[model samples]
Target: MVAMWSYSAGYNVVEVGDDVWDLIEERTLVLFNHQSTSDVPLIMAAFNSRPNLSNNIMWIMDHVFKLTNFGIVSWAHGDFFIHGGKQHREASLLELGSHLQKFYIPRKRKWLVLFPEGGFLKNRKASSQSYAKKNNLPVLENVALPRVGALKVIVDNAAAEQHTDDSDKIKYLLDVTIAYPGGRPLDLPTIFGGWRPACDTIFHYRRYNIEEIPKDEETLTKWLYDRYEEKEAILQEYYDTGIFPDAHTTHDPKFEPVETNRLTGQRVVHDTLEFILRHIFYIVSTWIWMSFLYWVFTSICQLVW
Candidate 1:
């Protein structure tokens, strides 16, 4: 997907945070802000250089997405396609909990990626604000108030006391904030059709040990909201100043920003290499599928004739 984006237009992805790659190797719960449908390419491009991390991660996505473009491949990779809306909400979360307990460790997944906002920012922002207004919480504009049900489900299974082996459970909380150029997000059309002046996919990452995060329902709910609040601040600052905060600016001891682009320097070799291999596989598979269809059609026509 990133390759296709790059091929269409030289889309660049920037990664910011400490120069540590340890969290990528650990059993981590990664939460991303849902901004647009085009976000996946950026995430893929970010970790594409590290195949172990990118390839081994499990995604939590909408059930309808299970029938979309890359849905079949996601099925092959064993990602959880969760149902959406209030009607299926409780059952979906229960199913998610069951899915995690059953497959998270057994399938050897290192990262569990979630968008706790439950939907895209544009779609959920109004309802999120209304809920905030009713509950006397801060009205967030940049990011939605995260639904804690999935987060609770994750922690209860992945970080709770159920696992006998400490090494097998989640050890870190990865907060990834995605930003597009000038606060303008790109969608599937923009990525596929490409754009002039190129589009930048900026990713800001912050990691905390699972021990530092709250595990209980109430505290964890507040903890999740607090993170979204921080995300709103971070995004606001970025939109206003065209740059994110550093320690001196935000007084955050955990933030040590080191930026890198995945498409530049020696990484270009890695990206191009993967691009060719991915395209080749897709092309060959598509050809084989077409051949089978052609054979079936020809046989039916012959019988009719």
Candidate 2:
């Protein structure tokens, strides 16, 4: 993503709010609104300064994503993919809950990332709205109604699961609102071509302590729906103002601006020099891991032959 070497397009994918939120170090359950296939790559670029997250993060994704170009990479990275739609929803969630209970501690996963809307807004919005109409829930314009099944499963089974280490457990839920400037989301080509977004794709964050969040099914589902309501409101305001308003400042709550504790910018890894340095670091690190893999492969081949 550092390919944005041009004078005009070389802008950083900006992180706007909640500057002090410990996104990098702490164990987290992150909610991201799915836009296009490019969101994951955009996240990779966002993690330019926090490269360990790129390696260690666990992504919970739609089962259909298995057919995408990134599928095998996700599988190799150990991301979780569960089937979608009502037919398989219950079974898939039950399976996911079971898997999380068994895997979270042993896998040493620090962050769990998922899209609660179940599908992209473009594909699922109409159905979401219809369901809202039937169920008497709010019909949102920017985001589809989020399905709570997976969220519930993860919260019930994975939230507090942790290694015996004294590290802080999954203590936070990061509600991340990703805005593609001018409603134009990035595509997969950017991974190879670089971050070519004419303007920066801005990220807004709100941190909630897991201890403060509701745990029961009914309350948790209500809390998630309330969050989607806030997400839609944020999106609408972003479209109107060309900026994400700090919820604390915008007649809303928790969306504080990070003037004193900015996360990524000139202080972060956005410069051309950092980009080159990162390239060098990765080039050197590549040999370290690849050499181990090479030895493993050769040893296995010798044993078989």
Candidate 3:
């Protein structure tokens, strides 16, 4: 469904990494920059382009998303939802950590997607800028300041889990940065209406092994901020110049792009056929219902006369 929607909307999603599959094969935590609601479909489309990456995947979503139809599906998929407000923030993170620990199993390939920015960059830019200025940090234009509390909880719990069972280790932290070339954010309505953005959607993925990250909360918090700072630099560069520099670099050599030719062709054909069949069914059903209504109306008129 994501692939069909993206392709139909004329989005050309390109993922650059050598070991994309290996990243998924490990106990992975995916951190991505959130731009718009369209980011969900775009990331799903990327996973769809690869084989088996979409399986055993879960997302950390804002609690408000759970109120939508997509939220129900996400809940069924074992995704976590958190209230981002000040009142429920701490409780939410604790609950999330508990859920992660509960669901984690040794040797199972699982990927948890997290957006540490807490909200969309555009919506939080003013506050981010103010906070950065107050703290004497550089003002970020592209990415927002990452809230580290949730990440700290997640990492601590994962580390504890690993300590209890050495086999249940977190393999890598995949830092994914998404950029829109034309600086226009894609929304659902725009995508469904086939309003293609001027440039292709690009996703840059880099992996940091768990051992490389610090165990201490303070150090880990700094590390998380540094990662977001790097993302800010990359995105700033992208906006300044219309290209992402050296986007294909990866830490692992074993990552190879899956053979997508066969899968893509089969999917395109399948989606097209399904679309046509659906329209035909809708048209026939509507015609039948309208015919029934007309017959009933005529019969009632004759009885009254």
Off by over 4 Å in 3: 106-109, 161-167, 247-305
TM-score of each: 0.89, 0.77, 0.79
The 10 consecutive residues of candidate 3 with the worst lDDT sum are 260-269
Candidate 2 to truth, TM? 0.77
lDDT of 1 by residue, 84-150 (tens): 7889989999999888877777887899999999898999999999999999999999999999988
Runs with alpha carbons beyond 4 Å of true place in candidate 1: 247-270
Looking at model 2, residue 45 earns an lDDT score of 65
Q: Which pairs clash (backbone N, Cα, C closer than 3 Å) in model 2?
A: 247-255
Best by TM-score: 1
Candidate structures ordered by lDDT, highest first? 1, 3, 2
Order of models, best TM-score first:
1, 3, 2
> lDDT of each prediction vs. the true structure?
0.78, 0.71, 0.73
Q: Which model is ahead, 2 or 3, in terms of TM-score?
A: 3
